[model samples]
Each structure stands twice: as structure tokens, then as C-alpha cells.
Target: MPSAHTKSPRAASRTPLIEVTKLSKVYVNDAVETPVLFDIDLRVQSGEFMAIMGPSGSGKSTLMHILGFLDRPTHGKYRFLGKDTAGRTDDELAIIRATKVSFVFQAFHLLPRATVLENVMLPLLYHPTIPSAERQHRAQAAINAVGLFERTNFLTSQLSGGQKQRTAIARSLVTEPQVIFADEPTGNLDSVSGIQVMGALEKLHASGHTIILVTHERSTAEFADRIVHILDGRIASDSRSHSRRSSSGLTSLK
Candidate 1:
């Protein structure tokens, strides 16, 4: 029998959720152009777990920003769900981000004084369509998914590093986006805490969420089924290979 992590044939055949062709990014300051990424072509399929790995100057973080619609590429054809995003205005991009994109970062960014439940529901507060009354219900569902339900009502300041990260994951999941961008999510964590977070991400992938993780650590990238490496602002390699220790072997921190 196929496991939950297995993508259905139908899913495999669908149009890629993200397609970037000849993508390039250049920053302009005082009329000077600083090139960051160049002619990058990539496709991210639905239900795939992929990691982007690179050193500090490789521009991976910039690529992540472009992928997440948090920033726009200077030149490229970027299609999300087969529709071109080149013409989208800043507000349109913001709408799309709010409605269809999820982000997890190294910084927990949770409200220090807010309860876990409140922090998780913060995204919904800005959503224009999600009913106010349904906010709590949706937040609860996301908290449960990340296995942070036990800490739902606890203040974020009271949580440990791992717990805080879990809370952040739940918060990101609250919007229920199709793709998730994790930017060096374990950068601030210790080994044990990192394992817990990776397992949580693996469980998310097993549940069919498309995960696009950005990391500088090989150990962290191993958790992904596919690893794409960037060097000097260009793709050095993209291998669907990993040396991940078995996920089942790790004791889940949540």
C-alpha cells in the first residue's frame, strides 16, 4: 500500500505549483545594479519536499524571498499555478502571500506576551474573508497539526526554544498555504531541538504539504528528499538524494 507521503499519479501530473524560467535578481541602489541570481530555472512540484542549500553569499535567501513572493525577481518568467505573476501589483502580491503563502523563519517571531493560541491566530486577524468567529477554530486546528495543542493557551515567552519554534510552525500553518518556505528554520536551535523541528517538517511533508526549506547545514537539508545547492548566486547542483537518518528513529519533541 502507498503511504501518505507518496504522491498520487494525478498529483505528479498536475502543473507545477511554481515554475521559474530564466529567473534573475538584481538589486538597484543609487542607480547601480547589483546582480544576485542569474538565469535560474526551477520547478517545484506539488507534494514535494525540497531544500535549497548554500553558503552565506550564495543568494539562496534572496531566491527564497522570490519564491515566497516576498520579493520580485528583476527578470524572469515566474508562473504560480500556471499563471504569470509578472503583472501582479504589490497589493496583489500581498494578497496572494496572505492567502496562499506560508513562511517559517529562524526567528520564532511569536508575540512574546501572547499565548500560543493567540500567536497562531495572528495571521487570521489580517485576513479579509475568514470570519472573525471562525478564527479561533482555525487556529486551534493548526496548533493541533503541529502537536502544540498542549501549549495552546500558554504564553509564548514561557516556551522553550523548541517549543517556541513549534508554536511558530503552528502559526505559519494557520493560513493553510499550499507551499511552505522555511528559511533556515533550525539555525537558532540546538541538536535536540533541531531534530524535533525536522521531524515536525517531515510529518508535514508526509501529510502532503509542499515544503521548500532553505538551509546552510547539510544535516538539516538531509531531511528533505531533494536538495538543491547554490554557489556564487547560481545553482551548483540539484540532486534528489539525501542521507537522512530515519525519521522514525528520532524522538519527536512535540
Candidate 2:
């Protein structure tokens, strides 16, 4: 039997940026335990675009939360950038989450009152290491990357749904994170808007940013180089897409 940390032979030479081994999560209240994720094993290489697809109750969001360091797993190992996160402190995890990983959500979690540029600069506030003067430059570059430069001075409320999503993406990029976790980025947008959002993400991927997307829509998942299907808290299938092959032509999630 394969161990919980198993990887395909084809991926042996490449180092995984994020590795999850026998990972599981459970919610406990009043001494009652509810398992939300099974013994999940996954490995994501740097610069790869991956999508996690599952129905409403399949635990995809739970998995993303755990992987993104927003929540901890009840059991198993989660290694980020080759460091095991089993006993890390919350502050340590927070630093890693803030600096190395970024997240975009379905709700577009932007401050309605803030301008698009301000919202994009929000992540830099937590990153004290970035010089104050450099923050604006980075934020502006991020907004431009998402094609929202024209709306940077506009209040977030003034932007369209697609532009709001772009601002969210811009905020995520302000930190120049190594990985991005997007949960239903286009969930609230129309088909055309969703396509634009996906296009922005695809452009990011082309720029060598690793992305993990969680979506129920097959059309959205099609943007990923590889897709993992989850069913009842377990991975049903992990496969590469013929339409989005990697540069090496060996993108495999086994």
C-alpha cells in the first residue's frame, strides 16, 4: 500500500512547494467531533496551477483553509516550503500566511468604502518589512497586473463585479506571494466576467505564480493545468488536463 505521503514516480525529481501527508481535520464542539476532511495527501509544485473541484459538502473549502494556513489540521503533516508545520505557533503561521501565501474568496472581501488602491495596499500594512514608499509602487503594479489600473482611484463599491474580483486579485498580488489560494473567485460573476477573472489568473500563472483554485464549475476548473476532484472528503481523482499541459509536458497530480 502507498503511504500517505506518496508521490508519483514522474514527479520524483521535482520538489513540491506544498506537501500534505495523511492530513485530516475535525471540528469539535461540546465533546462532539465532526470530521471534515479525510486522510488527504497532496503535493503542489512551484508555479503549477491546480484546481480542487467538489460539490458543496465535499470538504474542498476545508482542505483549502487548512492548506492555506487559515486553519490547522487535526492530524498529519503539512509541509510548506520544505518546513513541517506540525508544531508551529499561530503567530509563526500567520507570518507565513501573510508573507508567502495569499487568498481570494468568492465574496471579494474588499472594503466597500476604500478605494481600489487602498484595498490593494492593505496587505502591505501587515508586512512591515516592506518600506512605506515601496508599498504604493507594489500595489500599483499589482493593480496594473490585474488590468484594474484605470479604476485604482475609484472606491471598491464603484467597480463592477469583475473589477471587484480583479481588485481582490490585486490585493493578493501586492505581497508577491509564492502561492495563491482562490476559493470560487468567479462564483458571483456572470459568464463573461468569470472568463475575465480566469484570464487574469491565467496571466498570473504564466508569470510563475503557483495557484490553487477551489471551484465547482468545470469551466472554471478548466483553467487549471491540473485538477483534483474531491468526493465525500476524499480525493476521487487527480489528473492533468490535456488542454493545459505544463511546459515540461509532465504535469501530474497522483
Question: After superposition on all CA atoms, what RMSD does each candidate show versus the true structure?
Answer: 3.3, 5.5
Compose the digit string of candidate 2's lDDT tens values, residues 1-254. Answer: 22222234545566678899999889999999988899999888888889999999899999999989999999999998888988889998888887999999999999999999999999999885898899999999999999987898999999999999999999999998999999999999986777788888988988889999999988788789888999989999988866752312222221
| TM-score, cand. 2 vs. native | 0.91
Q: Which stretches of candidate 1 lie over 4 Å from their true place?
A: 1-12, 252-254
Instruction: List TM-score per model, in order.
Output: 0.93, 0.91
lDDT (Cα, 0-100) at 196 in candidate 1: 85
Model 2 — which ten-residue stretch has the worst lDDT? 245-254
Q: Which ranges in model 2 have alpha carbons more than 4 Å from their true place?
A: 1-11, 244-254
lDDT of 1 by residue, 134-178 (tens): 999999998898888888899999999988888888877888888
lDDT of each: 0.86, 0.87
